[model samples]
Target: MAVQGTPEPFVEILMSTVVALVRRDGPDLSARQFGVFLTVYLGEGPHTVRGLAKELNVSKPAITRALDRLGVHDFTHRQVDPKDRRSILVQRTVKGAALLREIRAIMGEAAAASDEAAPGGATELRRQHA
Candidate 1:
C-alpha cells in the first residue's frame, strides 16, 4: 500500500486539462455541443426527439436548442420519420462528421495526456498500471 501522505488522485485534474486543451484547440463546438453531436452521430439516426432527450438525460427543450445550434452550422438536419410522421429524426451532415472527426482527434489527445499525467490515477486505467 502507498503512504497516506501522498496526494490522493482527483478527476478535477483531468477535467481541467481537457478544458484547457479544448480552449487551445479552438473547437467549433463546446463540450455540450460535441456531446449532442456525438449522441446523434453515434446513434445513427431514425431516433425521435423525445428518444434522444431521454438517451441524453436532458430535457426536450435542451435537445431542441442544441439541434438549433447544430442547424446554424449545417452540422445536422431534421426530418420527419416516415413511419411516424409526427416524430423527428436528427441526421448528421457531412460537415457534422468532419467536425466530429476533429473532436475525436482532440479527445484522443486529451486521453493520452491524461494517462501520461496520471500514471496511476484512481481510475481503472491507473488500477491496471498498479
Candidate 2:
C-alpha cells in the first residue's frame, strides 16, 4: 500500500534512531547537523561546505563547526576541491555509512517493537513525517 506524496514509513523512525546513535556515539549534533547530513547524502553530486550552509540556512562558520564536530566521529572528511582550490568539499566516510546502517537497524527494530505493541506502527511513523 502506497501513500502518495508521503515519505516512506521507516524514514522518520530511521531519523530518530540515527539521532539517538549520534547522541550516544558522538558529540552532540543538533537537528541542523542531521539536516545537513541528510541533504548531503541525498545530493546527486558532492557537497561543499558553503553549499550546505546555504541549503541549511546557516552561516559558513556554523556549518564549519558542525563539520568539525562530525569530523571527530569520522562521519565526514574535508578535502580541497580540485577545481576550486580555495573551496573544501565534505564527503561521507565508510565509517559514516556503516554507522548509518547500524542506526537504520536500530530503527527497524524499534519499528517492529512498535508494531508489536500497536498495529499500523509503520503507518503511524509515516503520518508523523507528514
Candidate 3:
C-alpha cells in the first residue's frame, strides 16, 4: 500500500538523516557520490558508468569522479564488463552494504523521531506550513 502524506516529511527525514550521518565520524560522501553509491547498491547489478550517468541524468565523467571517491573507501569497485569489453561495470562491496544498513537505521530513527515530535506527524507539519 502507498504511504499517505505530503513530500515534506520525507524530505525532512532525509535531511535529518544526512545531517546525523555526516555528524558521525565516518566516510563523508558528497551528494553526487552518495547518489551514485545508492543507485548502484539499491538498484540492479552490473551497472555501467554510462548507465549510471543516464539514470542520474549526469555526465559519464561525473559518474567516474563519484566512483573514484567510492572506490577509495572500498564502498564500490569497477571492473571491465566481460560481456562488453568497452564497458565498465560498477560493483558493490561488503562495506557498502554495511554502510547502507547503517544509513537505513539512521533514517528510520529520524523518521520515528519526526513522527513523535509532531502530532498527526508530517500531515500536521504540512498543514502548519500551509
TM-score, one value per model: 0.67, 0.73, 0.85
In candidate 3, list every pair of residues with a backbone clash. Answer: none
Q: Model 1 over residues 1-130: C-alpha lDDT tens digits?
A: 5456543443444465557556764435666666788788887666667988898898989888888888898888989888888789888799888876865776566666655777655454556556
Q: Is candidate 2 or candidate 3 better by lDDT?
A: 3
lDDT of 2 by residue, 89-126 (tens): 99988877876676668877767765666678586766
Greater TM-score among 2 and 3 belongs to 3
Task: Please state the error at residue 4 of candidate 2 in Å.
Answer: 21
Residues 22-117 of candidate 3: C-alpha lDDT, one tens digit per residue:
899898999999999999999987799999999999999999999999999999989999999999989999999999999999988887788887
Off by over 4 Å in 3: 1-6, 122-130
lDDT against true structure, model 1:
0.72
The regions of model 2 sitting more than 4 angstroms off are: 1-28, 124-130
Q: Considering every candidate listed, which one attains the maximal lDDT?
A: 3
- Ten-residue segment with the worst summed lDDT in candidate 1? 5-14
lDDT of each: 0.72, 0.76, 0.89
- Considering lDDT, where higher is better, how would the candidates rank from best to worst? 3, 2, 1
Which is better, 1 or 3, measured by TM-score? Answer: 3
Candidate of highest TM-score: 3
